[model samples]
Each structure stands twice: as C-alpha cells, then as structure tokens.
Target: MIPHIHRRTFGTGSRPVLAIHCSLAHSGAWRGVGAALSDIATLHAYDLPNHGKSGDWDGQGVMHDTATDMALAVLDEIGPVDVIGHSFGATVALRLAIEHPMRICSTILFEPVYFAPLMADDPGFAGGYRHDTAAYDQALEAGDTAAAAKAFNSTWGDTAAWDTLPEASRTYMAERIHFVRDSAPFLMNDSADLLAPGRFAQATGPVLLMRGETSPWAEDLNGAIARRLPNVQEVSLPDLGHMAPITHPDRVATHVRSFWAAQGQGLRSARL
Candidate 1:
C-alpha cells in the first residue's frame, strides 16, 4: 500500500504546481518560493517519506516505489499538475514525468542529482565517484556519523557549509544519513532509459532546467539531461550554488514564476 504523504498548500490560484524538496529538507523548503509564486499558482509542497511529517514508507528504498507513491499522492490530492523539484526530488520528478507523462503538464527542476547518465557519458567519472564513496563508506563503518555527513555534504553542497550548520541541524542530518546513502544507488547506478542519452521523448511536457553557476557537478548533470529532453529551457543563476533553493528563494522563485507564467498561458490557450 502507498503511504500517506504530508503536504502544505499555499495560494488559491486555479493552476496547481506541486513542489518537492531535496534530501534532508521538508515542505518548508518551498515556503519562500511558493509564497512568491502564489499569485499565479496554487502550490502543493510535500515532505518526502521519512523527511518531515511523513510517515515511513512501507516499500523498500527502491526509488521507483517512492516515485509511484509520489505520483499516487498527486493523483489523490491534486490531480495532474505542473511540478517543481530540487536535487533528489528533482530526480524523482524526472521519473514521474517519464513514467507518467499524462500526469505532469510541465516541469521545473533545480540541480537534479541524476548522476546515472553522467556516469554513462564519462566512464572516468566513476573512478572519482568510487573514491568518494569509499571515503563515505569508511566513515560510516567507523561509526563516525559526523565524518560521513561531512564527506557526503562536501560533495553535494560544500565542505565549508557542513561546518556552518548548527549543532542541532548537524545532529538531525547525521541521524538521517542512512536514507541519503541508500538513495545513491538509485540516483547514480540505475539503468533506466531516463538516464540514457536522448531518452526523454516519453516525457511529453515543457521543462525548465535550472542550475547554479557555482555548482559544477549539478550544472554538468543538468546539461546532460537537458540535451535529451524533448522540450526544455536551461537557466544558470549567477553566483549561486547547489543550495540555491534553500538559500536564495527570491531569485529562484523569480525564475520559477517566469516559467509558470509562460505555462499558464499555454494552459489558457488549451482551454480555449
């Protein structure tokens, strides 16, 4: 059975946009962006299973199962709608758009950590990835949760950012490291066509891909995915990094709202 998903709704606009947050984050991550776009869209921000108010998912950590639950949640609560997601959530959004094409009208992804295609594109990348994973595994094996998180965060976000986290926040992230670690296989090792070059023909929708200028890895991944998408627009935010969604909502929201505005027009034309 699919588990119940916890969500927070914002705005009263007729058009709905479902916003999914990245790992280590909850629906609140969308608060600022949602508020900014509220004038044009009714945003439904959800907490992924085991993230915030959500309960444990009955299914295993397989990403497709999680995507199924997420798709169902959209069907049950909001029906087919446009979507916005970041990092891990952005990866799931890719699956939903690919597997359930009719359900997602449009998509906006920020730094989607879909690494499988990258590995496929460059075999040498795997060596570096393996080396990093080795370090992360070693820290975990040594029962050094802090070290593990530091290693993980340093790669995804920034090493210095981990030290800047508050003690309580660091503790919370350390506790949930297992979920983060378990998702790596699905993100980086999956063999699905969604991760293949030029395999986005199945995802029939307008797509907006956003990346921070300072985030090289994410930018490269986004670029690779963009090349395959049937319909896509790419944007790079100057002086921003992987955590732009959390740290610079106003700027992020500006780009998102612009996309939705264009999408809203398309929706209206379709209704005519």
Candidate 2:
C-alpha cells in the first residue's frame, strides 16, 4: 500500500516540477530553490516517511522501496514532470527517470548518494568512505542513537557543529538516525537493482547532475553516474558542499534555471 505522503507546493507557474529533499530534511528544504524557480515552474516537494510531518515507517519492507513508492505515488498524481532531488532523494529521482522514463521529462540530481557504483569501481575510495564513517556505524551498533546522529551529521551536514544546533533540532536528528542504517541496503548494497546493466542507459532524457566542489564523495559518485547516462550535463558549484541545495538554494537554483532553459531551447530546435 502507498503511504500517505505529506507534501507542499511551491512556485506559481504552470510547468510542473517535483523536488525531493535529502535525508534528515523535509519538503521545506526546497523553499529557497523552489521559490527561485517559481517564475517558470511550479515545484512540488514531499517529506519522506519518518521525516517532517509524514507518518512513521512500519518497519515492514525495504525503507528505500517505501520511500520510492511514496514519491511514485506523488509522481503519478502530478503526471509527467521534471524531477529534482538531493542526496538520497536524488537516488529516487534517478530511479524514477530510469524505470519510468515515459513519466519524466527531465531530471536534476543534486549529489545523489548511490554508493554501490563507487564501491564496485573504486574500492580505495569506498574503503576510505567506510573508514571515515566507521564511527557512525559503531555508534549504531552500540545502540547509541544520539551519538550516531551526531557522527553522521558531523560528516554530511552543514559546516555547523552538532552541539551548535538547537536542542530541538538535535533531538529531531536523534530520533531519525536509524534511517541511516535502514538506508544501507539500497545506498550501499544496490538493493534496488538500480545498477543492473542497461538500467541507467534507459533514462534517455536530458539530465543535469550537480554537485558541490567541496563535497568529498560527490565528484566520484556523480562521475560514476554520468558515465552511465546517455545524455547528461555535470556542474560543480564553487565553495559549496553536499548540503548546497539546503545551504545555498539561490546559487543552486541559478544553475537549475540555466539547465532548464538550455533544455527548453534544445526542445524548440528539435521541433523546428
């Protein structure tokens, strides 16, 4: 059964667009970017299960699958639309484009955390990533949810320190830290079968893959994804990190607008 996802619409344009936020964030994270794109496209953003106002996960099926299903339900309701996602959300966007190409007009992926490709192709980086994140893993194993959340956030979160965050924010993260573990099967192991041969090549539409130049693993991971895509444009934002979409939405939206415009021009030329 498709879970009831909580969503909020941004922008006032007729062209529809879907924006998926990264893990540990809610639909509101897209406010800045969505507002920036409001002139040309209406952006619809949703909170994943157990995040924001959405209901809790029943712990029944693969968490990633459940999240993807929630997004799919929204897509079906909104019809074919350009989709944008960040981090884990970007993985969902990629899957939707690859598996339901007919339903996606174009796609923008902001630092998708599809680690399987890198793990298989570059074991050195994979090892380094695991080594860097071992503390978070250890905390999870020890059943230290708060410590796990702090460790995870220290690495992937914004430049702010964990202790600097508001107490409520810290509490929120601690409650959902288990999602990091629940997401491992798909993000780390390719449980969704997204890497199966010929699957990525199936998304023939124009794709814009954006990453922050400062992000440690984004270049490598996005590079891996770019190699498999038939049509893709890569952009590296200066001085930004993995959380750029949330931290610097206006900057990200500038590139988004440019990419969307370029695609529009190409479509017009093709029709001509």
Candidate 3:
C-alpha cells in the first residue's frame, strides 16, 4: 500500500494538467511555468513520495512502485490529466502512462534521465550520481547542510543560474532537496535499455518527446523511443540544455501550445 501524497494545483478549466518534478527539485519548479500554461487549462504538480508535502513511502523506493502510487494519487486528487515531466520525473511520467493508460490524455517528456545506454556512453555517469548521493547524504548526516547543499549543487542540485533565484525559491529548494537526494534515483526504473519495451515502443496517447540540442548525451535513445511510439512527436531545442523549461519556457510553451492548438477540438475527445 502507498502513503498519502500532496500536490499543488493551479488554474480551473476543462483540460486538466499535471507536472511532475525532477530529482533535486519539487513541484515549485513549475510555479512560474505552470502559470503560463494554466490559462489554457488546469495544472497540478506533485511533490513526490518523500519530497515536498508528501509523506515518505518508506521501503517502496523502486521507480515502478513510486510511479504507480503517484499516477493513482494524481488522478484521484485532480482527475485524469495531461502530464508533463522533466528529467527523472519524465521517466516516471512515461512509466505512469504505461502502467495506467486510462489516466492520461497526452504526455510530454523533457529529457528523462534514462541511464543504462546514456550512462554507458559516458563511463561512470551513474556511478558518479551514486557517489554524489552518498557524499550529500554523509554531509547531511554530519549536520553540514551547507556542505550537503553545495555537494548537490556541485552535481545536480545547483544550477548555473540558481544563485539568481529569489529568496523564496531558494528556501523552497533547500527544504526539498533532502527528499530529492533520497527519492529520485529509486524512482528512476532504469533498465538495460532505459524504459520498458512495449511501454514506450507501443504507447497509446500523444507523446511529445523532446531534448535540447546542446544536451551532451541521451538524445539518441530518446529519439529512438519517440520513433517507436504510435502517435509521438519529437522535438529538439538547440539553444537549450537540461533546463529547457527554465532556460526557454517561452519556447517550450509555444511548442506545447501549438501542439494543443493543432489538435484543436479533436484532442483526446475519447478518453484512453
């Protein structure tokens, strides 16, 4: 059984929307971005099992189980939705779509952190991640939150533009990264090829798989997955990297808005 989960929702309209946070981050990442998308429809963002306001899942750290609980929780909390995910959250979004085909209208993934092949291309990538996690955990246990935060920022927690963030944003992340360091990798569901075969290869809804042009690796795998999906759209943002939503929210919003517009009234008229 899963524990209770909490989410933040925005907007109020016919189309329901949800955003799942990447590791080392929380639903707050989508605050400004969600505001932009909310006008078109409703938006909801999750805090993950141990992140944000959600209760910890204890031993259920595996990605599949976490994704399952989250998928059920989101639909139960805000009804069915169209999901958008970034990084590890995107991987969970993909899993949720596969596990519960009936809950999603459409899916958008921005650089899901699918390891395996991606990590293999760069030896020690996953190992480095594990090393960072351990180091941060040690730092936290030693009561050196600054050192822990610095260790995280040195790897995945800190961003090039993070110091410029507002005080509130900084505070929010400071409180959230503890859960991120604890929960993200466990919810990654990394397989030999990243995602499951029939899951990504034979998806049932519209999937917008995207990557940044300057992104160092993993585009090949994401592209390959996109090609296999029945109704998938592939996109690349040359100027963007891992932080597409933050680096180019306007562009991402445009691409999504256009996708939604093109579908028009025909968009998921019949529920999956």
Candidate 4:
C-alpha cells in the first residue's frame, strides 16, 4: 500500500481537479498550480505513496501498481475527480484512467515519461536513465550523500538547466532522493523495455497530451500519444520547456481551464 496523501483548497460545487506530482516531488509541488486552479475548481493535490504524508508505499506490482493504488486511495476519499499530471505523474494518471475509467472525468498529461519510443532515443538517453538509477542506489547504500546528489544532477544531463542548479539544491535533491529500485541497473532490470501505449487506447475519456515547447522529446511525443488515445486533445506550450508547468503556473492552469471548457458533455458523462 503506497500511502497517497492530498492537499486541497476550493469551492464545494466547482469542478473537482486532482493534481498529481512528478517523480521525487510531493503534493507540495502543486501548491502554485493548485492555487491557480482553485479559482474555478475544487482542487486536490496528491502526494505519491511514500513521498509525503501518505508514507506507506508497500504495494503489489512495481511502480505502476503504486500509482494505481494511489489513484484508488484518492478516488475513495473524493469519489471522482478531474485529473492533471506532470512528468511521471502523467503516466500514472493515464494508467488510472485506463484501469478505473469510471473514476475520472477527464485527464491532462504533461510530458508523461513512461513511454520511450516518443523520445528520439539517443540510445544514450536510455543508458543514462539506467546508469543514474544505479549510481543513486550505490551512493545511498554507501551513505555517500554528496555522491548521490551529484548523480542526480547528472541524471537529466541533457536538460540544459539541470546542471546549473546550485550545489546546495543538488545536495538537497540528493539527500532527499528515494529509489525503490536502488539504482539505474535495478531500474533497467526491473521495468519493461517501454511502457505499452496500447494499454490506454480503451480509456473512456478525453486525454489532453501536452508538452513544453522546448522539451527534450526530440520528436512529436505528444502527437504519438494523440494517435494512441481515443479522444485526444494535444497542445504545446509555446514559450516553455519541460519544466513549464512549474515555472509557469498561470499558463498551465489556463491551459487546463481552457481545455476543460472545450470538453463537451461526452467527457463529463463518462462513468467517473
């Protein structure tokens, strides 16, 4: 049971919006965006099973199971919700909508990472993701916190600004890093080669696949996702990158609101 926690604020009768966080970040990461959404929604910001208040993450399968369990926990508490996810959380949101089509009104996925073919695989990118996962595990086990932090800073090595984060920030990211699969080797060994896009084709709701203008997708991952989804709404943030949702909360919120407004009754009438 990966314990999922949520922090929320909003009006009672407004549309319900649930924001799921990216890897490592907890519910607190949504504070800025949640506040924006609250103006027109009853927003709920979720914390991954072990990352925040809901600290127990023990679950059946691998990471996907943890994501599904967290979704169930959220639904149990609030009945149904309109979901929004960032990075890895986007992947979770898609999975939950597929597994529990009746529990979600709509979904917005911002650069979901579980899918790999979308990334113009440099072969190096895949190697790096796996390598860093292992390095972090090794550092954690050896109690070398600084090494762990340095490894983290380099994981997203391709990101132009990742390496520029101050040493203190890197240290902080390192100190707080949590890896259920130790390092990259474990990650590669434990997970599948790539997330199966077909798994989500049957989800009974509209999917808004978004990517930042300067994202590292190397190609049209958003378009690929759109092709796979039954009802897809695709958008690209013009003046932003992969971190746009965090850096530009107002824009992200506006995107969500606009997309929701455009959704016809067909989405609202879905099981969830």
Please tell me which predicted candidate would have the highest TM-score against the true structure.
2
Off by over 4 Å in 2: 265-272
Q: Highest lDDT, which number? A: 2
Cα RMSD to the true fold for all candidates: 2.5, 2.1, 4.0, 4.4
lDDT of 4 by residue, 1-272 (tens): 46535555544437777778776566776767777777677767767765556565563457556665666777788777788888767866876777677788899999876545443323456665555478766886798876765665455332445468777656545645654342222123324333455655657687888888777651355665566678888888886777666778788889887888888556666654
lDDT of 2 by residue, 1-272 (tens): 65679999999987788888888888999999888888888989999989999877789878988888898888879877889999989998998889888778889999999998888788788678879999999998999989999998988996689999999988888999998788889889999787888988899888999999988788999999898899999999989999999889899999988998888745423422
lDDT per residue for candidate 1 within 1-272, as digits (tens), equals: 65667888877777788888888778898887777777778878888877788776654657546754765677566777888889988887877778777778888899988888788778898788677678778988898888887777877664358879889877866876766766767777873556554457888788899999888577679877887788898999999989888888889989987887777677534522
Q: Ten residues in a row with the worst lDDT in model 3?
A: 186-195
* Candidate 3, pairs of clashing residues: 153-158
Q: How many residue pairs clash (N, CA or C atoms closer than 3 angstroms) in each of the candidate models, in the order given?
A: 0, 0, 1, 8
lDDT of 3 by residue, 44-123 (tens): 88777666777766664454466457757777867667888887788777766666667788888888766544453456
Task: Give the lowest summed-lDDT range of ten residues in model 4.
Answer: 181-190
TM-score for each of the candidates = 0.90, 0.95, 0.76, 0.76
Q: Clash pairs of candidate 2?
A: none
Error of 1 at 203 (Å): 1.0
* Least well predicted 10-residue stretch by lDDT in candidate 1: 263-272
